[model samples]
Target: MPGSEHADRTEDGLSIPRHRVLVTGATGLLGRAVYKEFHNNKDWHALGTGHRRARPRFLRCDLLDEDAVKAVIRDFRPDVIVHCAAERRPHVVERNAEAAVDLNVKATATLAKEAAASKPGAFLIYISTDYVFDGRDPPYGEDDTPEPLNLYGKSKLDGEREALRHCPAVAILRVPVLYGEVEHVEESAVTALWDQVQEGAAGSCMLDHCQQRFPTEVRDVAVVCRALAERQRQDPSSVRGIFHYSAKEQMTKYEMAVAIAQAFHLPASHLMPLTEQPAGAGARRPLNAQLACCRLRQLGLDVQPRPFRTAITDCLWPFLPDKRWRQTVFF
Candidate 1:
């Protein structure tokens, strides 16, 4: 009964049984959000692991190191582990295929096996991507067989299988291009484009006009991860297997760039339209990678992903001047 306060429900009926939640890739976008959510929640014994970072309860452990993974498992014994790390950049993965496999595939398998061995029914939520599909299909569902066009997708699909094989019961949440605000300006793919638009001459950004993507909000994603982690603690049987969560809107990179330009009161005349993938892109891009979140909706989960336009405001608010925004009467 020493740490009983950490467990058990409070008088207000807010706190559930406290769970030891370990989030991997705590330094990354979604990982940071997830870790922050866990850290803020009083019901979670949150511990984050990443490389070369120091937060309140964060550990600096590289997932590629097997000894480090084992050491974390031995020391923490987390009841629920949310794995938000992966080799995401398609071109980067193409250049380093072996490293991709090691990070995306081997790291997941290691974590899953460790979780299974450490705690029975330990929930592992693997953050996957829409690249698992060939992009030829539209609105890919959970049942669709993976046909990855690039190394990143293939590595993620392989990682998915490995996690399924090792973890007791896991939620493989596949997301789309995420946009969020971070300590740095160009942290995510969307923000990278935003940063490009923010600082450049006319006609700087030329984005793909035809390729479609669901611009998922990282805050919405963090909310869902919190639900899954808490459900894993309260009712592990509720969520299992592969699921997709993305914005309802299907936007072109061209449209997204235009939106970003408009959101921050920047000129869009310079944003050129791209018909094909740019030269030296390294890997083939997913031209039609749209994801549907019907599963989460069907399950009646709270805090679904918001429209990309609304999420855009959340990302750009920090960059906008209060009086300038007030003068323009921008919502």
Candidate 2:
């Protein structure tokens, strides 16, 4: 493994066991969470990649650059590659379809091919999205057919398909809204709202829509990735398929906003409830992005779902102000 350091030696001077891992998209929200979990573990030597700013040991390379990606794979010789880099913004993807396809689909395919050829037994875990499914119903499961409503989701789905062809040793993990604190910034939906509350921005409390799906915390999603990595390490040929990672329960956009407000001790009236309408500029969202984790549970990786209130509190507490804010804002 490239980044691994031998801790001890046998009588004959054989090195101790270690696993070297590489993570792409180390700067994004979920990617940062995964990096934090793996980077700090002693058993795993971690290398992270970013397109722009190089953070400490992180490598600077765009995923679209095939030669650069291949060089990193060959040099690092990682035991596992967690692919998270992508053009994630829906609106941006809609506007720049070529860029989105290049980054989200073509780059993923290239990484899978390079990883498989460079490190034959290495496991490749691709981070997917719940947006793949059109939210037509509540609590969609793994077996449920995907009907992506936007370019972002379709691109990710295409990436998943391309990855499977190039890398058989792969696990596709589809997750929902990830919220938490990392790198001193709040990136999740809940945290975004908390920032508004802290600033006494009444608009934060009121922009609720009826359409939304289950929300999963960043920490929980990290745990799932860790478990999947460990599983791959142990068996290498274990069940490989699509897995859903999200809070078990469902919630609407309006209800979710209200819960966040309550967690921050702000009045619900500050929130504005808006009718569920298709996103205008970007691609339309699936009405039911809720994912059923039954298959994931069957694999013995059943993640305990956190309640909405608990999730809200856990996400917003860090951003809560020391003093109380006004509760008379219009909903």
Residue pairs in candidate 1 whose N, alpha carbon or C atoms collide under 3 angstroms: none
Per-residue lDDT tens digits for candidate 2, residues 220-304, read 7877888888887777677587888888656666777667767656667655677757456356877668777876788798777
Quick one: RMSD of model 2?
4.4
Model 1 per-residue lDDT at 198: 58
lDDT of 2: 0.76
Which whole-number lDDT from 0 to 100 does residue 218 have in model 1? 85
* Model 1 weakest 10-residue run by lDDT: 1-10
Model 1 agreement with the true structure over 1-331: per-residue lDDT tens digits:
1132266655897556467788998888888888888888877778888776645557888899998998898787777788988778888898888988999999999999998887444678999999999898787888888899888989999999999999877899998888886666567777667765655464466777878877888888888888877665566777888888887777787888788777666788778788877676578777887876767777766465677766776776676546766457464
How many Å off is the CA of 265 in candidate 1? Answer: 2.6
Off by over 4 Å in 1: 1-17, 54-57, 199-201, 278-280, 320-331
- What stretches of model 2 exceed 4 Å from their correct place? 1-17, 182-186, 195-205, 278-281, 306-331
